[model samples]
Target: MYAIERFESRCKKAIESILKRSVELEVPPPEIGALFALPCHGLSKYPEELAGELASKLESLDIDLVGKIEARGAYVNFFPSGEFYEIVLREILQKGDDYGSGEKKDEVIVIDFSSPNVAKPMSVGHLRSTIIGQSLYNILTFLGYKCIGDNHLGDWGTQFGALLAAFELWGNEEELESDPIRHLFELYVKFHRESEKNERLEELAREKFRLLESGSEREKELWKRFVDLSLREFQRIYDLLGVKFDYVLGESFYYSRAKRLVQRALEQGIAKISKGVVVIPLEEFGLPPLVIQKSDETTLYSTRDLATIEYRLEEFSPSKMIYVVGAEQKLYFKQLFAAARKLGFNCNFVHVDFGLVTIGGEKMSTRRGKVVLLEDLLREAIAKAKQVIEERNPLLQNSDEIAKIVGIGAVIFNDLKGDRIQQVDFDLNRMLNFEGDSCPYVQYAYVRGRSILRTAGVTKVTLESVELLSDYEKKLIELLSFFPRIVKLAAETLKPHYIAQYLLDLAESFNSFYTHCRVIGSPNEATRLAIVSATTHVLKSGLSLLNIRAPEMM
Candidate 1:
């Protein structure tokens, strides 16, 4: 068990014993089970009559794990004993990388995120979903949950039709070889421009899509090429971000199953045909009717989503299905989940909606091309990071590698350091700052701790001399002991920012300890070294959960 758990148990046991000794206790003890910080204002929900009795009883009881116990009004507070700090330090050094993890669970969790469209360039809009999903995956896996990250690619729909028409009309073989996505994007933009002037061009695109859907030999081959080119381009970005998936299935992957699922829903009367379109009416649930098929008999997003859920249920039997999508699609997920339940999918469904990423207080629109490409954002971040590295640590080796880690880490940390539901403005200047609450700051703390250990040249740690510890040292140990609880809370709440914020707090505590307590020339140098070692390991582990790297020197 963790130090915090042990402390809570001991404190509860002490309170129970005190209540048992009381003779005027007509009712049982007010369940003084929860662990609260010292100097609590009052014990909420406890009877006012027993306030004095409770305080008097708690004051008489002696708990070895608790260094100090205070009873103010009806509230009881407990502070950790010196032995508590010793146990925390020992556990951290022994557990090392596995310090913050929990026992394994036998349930599978499937996370769906980063469903970038095939024919379009990945924009900044997809950033939140990608990073947030990856963070959740890492946290759940750390806590010993079976996790499968599925990248549900947008490989079907009208966009592909537009791309196919654009290629036939304006695509060049040489330009495609040079840069497929950019070339395809330009052609796609041109097609939309031409379609406005010639309305017939729109019909041509629709017909082309119909041909592709019906398995036309030529159109199918072209459609496959577009998917192949998009996947190859998307892979480069995914590699740079250090993200991978167990399944890279797309909307087209469910095409074969979607029709059957929709037909069954219609047969069961869960979905009905209205005006030649198949939809599930959810007005009772305060959501719009979920359209599974268009009037022209074409499968829509709802169809594919339902099909994906069905496939997952049969194959993985996941206990939960989490969709990390934009807040704009809040209603869409509400409708999708409602439809899934109506269709008899009994698994837990969670829609992790995140706020939008705006540039200069303006929403991004891919249709107007008023958006920053994710690749460009990453490149600019790397360049800025390189400049910082050159200015701060010019003589450092592997400058390029370190710059990449810091640059990418800055971008990710900036996105994750706030409440997931709050809007994020992509501010490179603020994100790259080395002094503030940024990735560089936490990473620098780790580097500084390592530098201390290296200078001391202490290969082993001895706890025998740790007879006396300062307030700063004890506080640092207390913060270290809370790592496992923090991780568990983050996973339970499906919020990565909790981990991000905790790292910042832990870094602040470590910095305080480093400032006041000298580790190298201290009376208990070996004990201090152990503390420093534990801090470095924890910082690295915490950063890893956020999918960031902790450099030895920054």
Candidate 2:
């Protein structure tokens, strides 16, 4: 158990014994300087009376972890013992990388994110879903939840028909071989532009899509090539981002199952036919009706999504299904979840909705060719990071590798540092600033801690020799002890930004300690060395939860 857990348990026991009743306690913030809260349901009218009674009872208890117990109104607050720092520090050093991790839960979780469309390059808009989903996966897995990341690829739809039509009209084998995604996107753009001038081209594209869906050999072959080429390009980006999906199930994977799902829904009366179209009427639930099939009897996105839910439940039996999507799709998920519940799915469903990522106050639009490619963004970030590395530490070896880590880490950190639902503007200048709440800043703190440990050259830490630690040391230890709690909160709230902010706080604490305290040749060198080592481990582990790398030298 963690030191805080032990403290909470002992405090609860003490309260229970004193009041002769079961009590639940909560840990307040550090600045509040209160460690526990006791409900005074029966004594609300006499809060001071309850406070006096509990204070007397707490004083009589034989608790060593708490040095002082005070009554504030109807609540009793417990303060940690002077020796708490020693206990927490020793535990941190002993646990090392596993200091803040929790025990495994006996449930599986499914996460759907980064579902880029086929024959299209990933744009900046996809970054939020990818990085946020990856971070949540990391945090939940760290907390011992069985996590399954599914890249629900958008490999089906009328868009593919447009691509096939354009390719048949003007595709070049050599151009496609040189750059598949770019060539395919150019063809897609051309199709839309021509269709704007020639309305018949739209019908032709729809015909091509219908043929593809009906499994025409020629259309199927073209569709397969588009999916294959798109996946290859996506794989390159995923590799750079260090993202891996357990299931890369695309919309086409559900094409066969969608008809069955619609039939089941119709049979179960979950869906109804109206005006030659099939939909689930959610008007009573104050939501738009969910369309399952078009007037032509062709399936829609909702149909595929419903099929996906059915398939996932049958395959994984997940305790929770989380969709990491933009907030604009709020109503879509609401209707989907409601339909699933109405269809008798007895499981948790959540939509982890995030705000938009804009550039210069304008939303990204791939159709208008006014968008930033994720690959281009990453390469530019790497290049800028290389410039910084050369200026700061030209003598550093493997500079390119370090630049990659720092550059990518900066982008990820900037994305995750804000609340998940808050809108974020992509500003390269601000994100790469090493002096702010960026990944580079926290990483540099980790490097500083490592440098201290290396310079100290201490192999062992003696607890007895570590007495009467300085104020900064105490603050650092206090912050370190809160790591497990922070991890738990992040997992419970499904907020990766909590971990990111916690890391920034821990980094700041360590920096203050480094600035104020000496470790290399001090009287408490061994003790300080132990603190430095523990801080380094924690920073690395915390950064890893956000799916950001912490370079030892940077």
Best by lDDT: 2
Candidate 2 Cα deviation (angstroms), residue 391: 1.2
Which ten-residue region of model 1 has the weakest summed lDDT? Answer: 21-30
Runs in model 1 lying further than 4 Å from the true structure: 12-35, 38-53, 72-74, 193-199, 459-462
Error of 1 at 357 (Å): 0.6
The residue-by-residue lDDT of candidate 1 on 1-554, one tens digit each, is: 88877776666666557555312111113244223532222333554435555555665666666776555454455667778888888888888878989789998999998999886789888889999999999999999999999999999887778888889988898988888888887888788888889998888888887777777899889888888999998998888788889999999999879989988998999999988899999988988899999776778878999999999999999999999999999989999999999999989999999999988989987656777889888888888898998998789899888888989899899899998999988676776676778999899899999999889886555565465888788778878887888898899899999989989988998999999988888787888898999999899999999889898887
Q: Number of clashes in model 2?
A: 0
Question: What residue pairs clash in candidate 1, if any at all?
Answer: none
lDDT of 2 by residue, 347-370 (tens): 799999999989998988766666
Best by TM-score: 2
Task: List CA RMSD, all candidates.
Answer: 4.2, 2.5
